[model samples]
Target: MIYFYNLLLLILCYLSEINSARILGIIPTPSISHQIVYRPIWKELSQRGHKVTVLTTDPINDSSLKNLTEIDLSFSYDLYNNKHNFSDKIDKLAGKPLEMVNAIITMNADICDEQLKHPKVKRLINDPNEHFDVILVEILQPCMFAFAHRFKAASIGVVSMDAQSAAYDSVVNPTHPILNPDFMLPLAGKLSFFERVFSVVISNVMRVYEFLFIIPINDKVIRENFGDDYPSCKDFIQYLDMLFVNVHPILSGIRPNVPAVVNIGAGLHIQSPKSLPEDLKSFLDNAPSDVIYFSLGSNVKSKDIIPSTRQIITETFAELPYTILWKFEADSLPNQPKNVKIMKWLPQQDVLRHPKIKLFITQAGHQSIEEAIFSHVPMVVMPFFADQEGNAKRIVLKDIAVKVDHKELTKESFKSSILEVMENKKYRENVKKLAELLQDEPMTGLEKAVWWTEHVIRHKGAKHYRSAAIEMPFYEYFLLDVIGFLLLVLFIVIYVSVKMSKLVFKVIFKLCGGEKPKFKRH
Candidate 1:
């Protein structure tokens, strides 16, 4: 028996080596919310005998994962933290579309710039011996996509949010300016005339700006690092092997994707519920009634909230009948209520999975919404910036949540929104249905992600999955060229017929009365 077991272990080792790949993943978005989406991916790939080298802001420094190599790009967060404070800008950037877009574009470029400057990253790029079967890069940072060019490997664009409008264009995935709108915009549902105009105008304007100004800037950065002979970032984007979008139809609605694009649902980082910490367990386990879990996610700190709003929240919570678990960063609230429990951090998934959790008051981050749905809890979304507003609108449209206007937030409005979702049976019912649909897929999201990643590596590239629309010009793809040709032919036929009719009229008149007309003219 011992001899047979040894032989089986040897056969398994041989198979692992035969199928193993060298994967390079550079997901340098400094947000923990973003990093969590891909963390599971790295772990899964390594466990399957792939040699994975990842450059990330949040490193899963687990020594147990012997096949994973994590390059710490945590300092990129400093480049952001030193330059800007997200807490201050979160509310201010809301509803300011141009400002919000410009900020995101600048930050993407800046992060890419900082990523190239890191000593380990520089060595990795400079090393002539380094090779990879595939490179997974952040779709947000086009400059970093140059790694694919340098390594001469298949490139897969990975985004932690729903695929943005510009991203769809890169993959030739179907998108409508008003109907599908950019995720960054706060617009959704049936648009009013002005809203439709705004969506169409802004989406086109940004598309042009991104192609002309942003891509050129990113291209220059790429050429600087990867050499001038490297292809333009625009060209690189057009040839992406595959794009992994963190979207599922259950939450984000039904959107079209090309064969090259894969929807690896948003709950990638969610793990099985663990035993809660003693303090939280005691607080939750003994709650007198139902509980409300409130959090604004990682980027927006609860302590940074304005004093007036804080007071309003405190006063309102004091009157509520249920227990409130507020993820407040500070140690204590000025006037804490007996029913309110403040914790600096939370195991959000575990907390939401608690039986007593009735409703979640969230900032409407995608992952947070996914967690709430997965746990079958409803939400009162207070969207602040970026995709949060759109996510809030989507969840509300799906009948799984309610939205509170952060701009007009008051004690009454805040309290009412929370109560509305908690008291309504429809919200809970809708969320439960959504959770079931999301979980009813043939393969789990993580499994699908791993399968697709390996598929690209196994085939060297997913060129067969590429869309013909990617190779076509905009006029041809929209059939405007064909339409123009038909219109031109119709015009020519009408012009010729008019001329023929006039000439025949003159001929008939002359033939009938030629001599009489000539005498009159003389």
Candidate 2:
């Protein structure tokens, strides 16, 4: 009887089906890390029984599986095949990050407007007899904002990186806190007043951008494509209105939340943990000391790294009490050290999870950093560009990591930083404590994300979760004008008090002994 009951319970759990709906996931990741970041959400949505239609670019077409629709943008194909160093061209484009984003938006806008015959976009804007119910959209591409408007599907913006990943960083506020999720991931002890203020400002700006830029563009796209025949853009946008962000509140440093936005940290996306090769496992288990894993992300070529830095690592690992597994792209390291092992590709999360893996010297990319946090492994961060700098800063400031620059990538500095993380033990303890908080949350990142996603779907949109700024202008939403008016009133009162005080002092002096000479009452 007990066995029968247990079997029935298992059957019932397995019978759990998704809310009767299909989710059309539109991700615009032009880079590999971005693709990896979106993977968990993709997997979760699919596992939840939602058939996903994905539209994005991949340099090398990844192996496809059941229930996934992949539309490659070919954003990095030639670059990947040729192994080109063309990134300098993109980075050197002179503009603020927001301006750069605006440029990208306009560029895509121009393509849509100027060349309506383009095959890629024609398919996107094509009229389909069958309609999609919910559209999970990523913000990086900006091209897919038009999809929600055209299809009249519920749309949610999957913010892949920190709040700075969008236009809200320098525009009106700062989302620096969204980087590591702890109060600005303090420089020394805690976030300074200015840092806190900056973080608030970033949050405000992100809210503002979704309002001013994303919404208006989405509306315009729908208006243009459907010729006002489309349904109200507002209904569809705010309807499937969930902000599926890959952020943990603990690492974010701020627990404050906006309605409807699910903070799923890096979640399961970063951890592409695969079973280790038997040979590699044997090698590690046979090793005398703990190991250090080093890799710059996928887009960053280890072979392209200046030979000087490579030599520093090879020699430095030889001196340490540990082995080093460096993920190098090339066939082999020219001057090899016996203590160092080079593999073209290593299972990053799997290596980190190993009991003998002591420390990670990383590029401080958001995904890797979170993986390290999840595994309770400390980091020696060497941020290369963009948000890496911010991520590295947070790790160091949080006392869980020590930051060293690429320019400072010397044997001595690298060895010292690794040794400090290995020997001190506090860094590991601090990271472990944070990992506890991140893990002990009510739900796992993936679970929270899927539940909220289904909630948005079941409710037919997340309009309730939206920030009111979606319908209101920045001035009205933040009530900046009202605040200014109140400040002005306060200034007036202060001025009046000072004047009254002066008058009272003069009257008192005149009444006592000192005469009010050269003074007249008005």
Error of 2 at 311 (Å): 3.5
Number of the top candidate by lDDT? Answer: 1
Local accuracy of candidate 1 as per-residue lDDT tens digits, 1-522: 999999999999999898999999999888999999998999999998999999999999999999999999998777776676556776677788788777777877877887898889999999999999999998988898889988899999999988788888888998888778888888777788998898899899989889777898898788877788988888888889999989887667677778898999857778878999998999899999999998999987889877887788889899888999999999888999999989999999999999999999999999999999999999999888888998999988999998988677888888888788878899999999988888888887799889999999989999999988887888999999999999999999999999999999889888988654455554
Q: Candidate 2: worst 10 consecutive residues by lDDT?
A: 165-174
Instruction: Give the worst 10-residue stretch by lDDT in candidate 1.
Output: 513-522
Candidate 2: tens digits of C-alpha lDDT, residues 1-522 = 999999999877666543446777765545667777666767767766777777655422435546666666564444333433333322333223445445445444433332233365566567576467788776544445557767667777776665432423212222345333322122323566786676566545645765687556655655665467665444453444666667664554454446655677745575545778898888788888788888887656678766776678778888888888888888989878788888898777788888888889888877888888888999998865556666787678778999886655788888898899989989999998888777776677777777877787788776666555566666876689999999999999999999999999998987878965576789
Candidate 1, after superposition: displacement of residue 458 in Å? 1.2
Q: Model 2 off-target regions past 4 Å? A: 1-19, 58-66, 79-121, 165-240, 270-274, 478-480, 483-522
Best by TM-score: 1
**What is residue 267's positional error in candidate 1, in angstroms?**
2.7
lDDT of each: 0.88, 0.66
